[model samples]
Target: MKLQQLLSFTRKAVDEYQMIETGDKIAVGISGGKDSLTLLYALSGLRRFYPKPFELTAVTVDLGYEKFHTEKIDALCRELGVPYHVIKTDIAHILFEERKESNPCSLCAKMRKGALNEAVKKLGYNKVAYAHHKDDIVETMILSLIFEGRFHSFSPKSYLDRMGLTVIRPMMFVNEADVIGFQRKYDLPVEKSRCPVDGLTKRQYAKELIHQLELDHPGAKQRMFTAILNGRIEGWPVRLTREEVKSSS
Candidate 1:
């Protein structure tokens, strides 16, 4: 998708969920991947003319891998005129060397988020923007159902009461395919994930499962996303109708 298209989808989610407020400072969690880079571009572009003024900061937590680097990400942040911060941590070693746990994704994710949240809190940002898109939302719901026997996915906007931080998914309406197109069209500085188990996880399985379901049913993915919107999941924002949106604007 083009930058304008991305901005439209992002702005829709942000407005529907009331994610941003005047004088709000949001930290965009960057993993140097296509999705996150796309989010950075969307938010930076949105910042220019959105009625509610806000600030953007790009942040990436370096997981202490030998080949992990953020030089390109730093340059991109500079180009966007957003401040960039990289928090160096030994999370890689702790996960693979020290603790040596068999199932590391869960623990590693918790550690990484903990580190990111602490750094964001220290930076005085009130909110954090995650890069999860529409596909991710549906895939997560599938994962929860298959593994935990529950029908659930994350909300577009959620509050971490303990940390006093609000998490917002502005790209929730953007598809993963669109994210790839945007990255290629813009030549974003996408970085390869250095994680040892990058694609060999349950999430990957769920993603592939959804792809197959879409192929078989031809509109299954869209139906699932629609279901998610109308499911009344806790903490999910009440979706605004076209009339409501017009009135609000």
Candidate 2:
């Protein structure tokens, strides 16, 4: 997964979902992980010649973990020439020390997203890019089915009415394996997640299950991804491209 490969997948998702528009200011949520860093690199490269020029800002909602260091992330952002912001929050302490919730992932995620949305809004960014890839979409769908008894996954593009912000998943077409490869090939400065429950969450379980299923039934992952794209799920419709509109007319 070289930079060109990343850009190709990203552009496909962006074009299919109509995720970007000229003059759009999109903020990339930097979790200091491989996924987010790869996203930053892809988007930074995309900005060079993407027909619909858009600006980007890298943002991270620091959860106030003692071991989390963001200096490398700052340097990466600087090297990419993307402005970065880290919203400091005591979310970890609140979830672990004060509230002491048995299930803290949900609460921590909510707090982090709230902080991120507020920060982006204040920074005047109307759109945010999350690094949810193909695997994440499939795993989420599986999780929903197994846990919630429903088939649902996050959309490639979503508009948060309250926040007046749109969320885009430019990496939706990229595979998690490719993301990992990209990180390694590019030597992305990945900051390890300091969350205590990082790999013990429901999502992590879903990921393992998916991996086993793929091993048992080869090509299962690709089949599932195809199903998701054509499943007619809400907000999954392919936006009409300009060429398609012209041809139809």
Candidate 3:
């Protein structure tokens, strides 16, 4: 039952969003975490018996946690036969030592994403996918609403026009709980890492708070996702006919 749900959710998102095509070579960004591991595994499951011809590769960016290592992840990728690339960057030290900002997670994420985007492009992969899940989309939507004064969420399919790259989140429809459950069911090897501000960050607080809100209102989480799925929250203006837009202009 669990496997069926996971596969259905993934396949629907993939087909509906057109994340990858028959000949597209996709590079997945795996961070040695459950969300990423689940995503890679799901893609593996899809590829094993999939009729279409496509390619999958794994890339992990070493954020230089020192305590955080990549050997285990390397072995996992080897077993999966997913060609892996590890790019090491001193992101932690840079965030802690150079800028010395009290809040480093946000900046560190930006730096890490920039490094990954550049690496994937240089490595000659045309499509790059991340493992952001439903919870992440909800949290990001809430964050944008409260902090950025916008209720926007990142699209399942988005293009980075400046870089000529396509960024995709193939796990957008699945939630964190399901990913964790799958990890436990499959006994996936997840290496532990020590983030400097592990529990002191705002996102951690948001997760806890959101969980509490869901507890208070039983269907809150599902409702939040449904809003996205049905496009109830996106504030994009309605597209108009050429005559209408021309008259407005």
What's the TM-score of each model vs. the native? 0.98, 0.96, 0.89
Query: What clash count does candidate 2 reach?
Result: 0
Candidate number with greatest lDDT: 1
Off by over 4 Å in 2: 237-249
Give the runs in model 3 whose Cα sits over 4 Å from its true position. 1-4, 232-249
Name the 10 consecutive residues with the lowest summed lDDT in model 3: 232-241
lDDT of 2: 0.91
Best by TM-score: 1
**Alpha-carbon lDDT, every model:** 0.94, 0.91, 0.79
Candidate 3 has an lDDT of 0.79
TM-score of candidate 3 relative to the true fold: 0.89
Query: What is the overall TM-score of model 2 with all chains considered together?
Result: 0.96
Error of 3 at 114 (Å): 0.8
Model 1: clashing residue pairs?
Answer: none
lDDT tens string, model 2, 1-249? 889989998987887778888999999999999999999998999999988889999999999999898999999999999999999999989999999888998878889999999999999999999999999999989998899898788899999999999999999889999999989988988999888778999999999999999999999988988888878887665766768634533
Write model 3 residue lDDT over 1-249, tens digit each, in one string: 266687777766676666666777788998888888888887877777655567889998898877777787777788888989999998887877777778888888888888998889898888888999999988877777678997677778777887777887878889898898998987777877567687787677767878998999998978977776666455322333555533543
Superpose all Cα atoms of candidate 2 onto the true structure and report the RMSD in Å to 1 decimal: 2.0
Q: What is the lDDT, from 0 to 100, of the residue 41 in candidate 3?
A: 82
How well does candidate 3 score on lDDT at residue 36?
88
Error of 3 at 221 (Å): 1.2
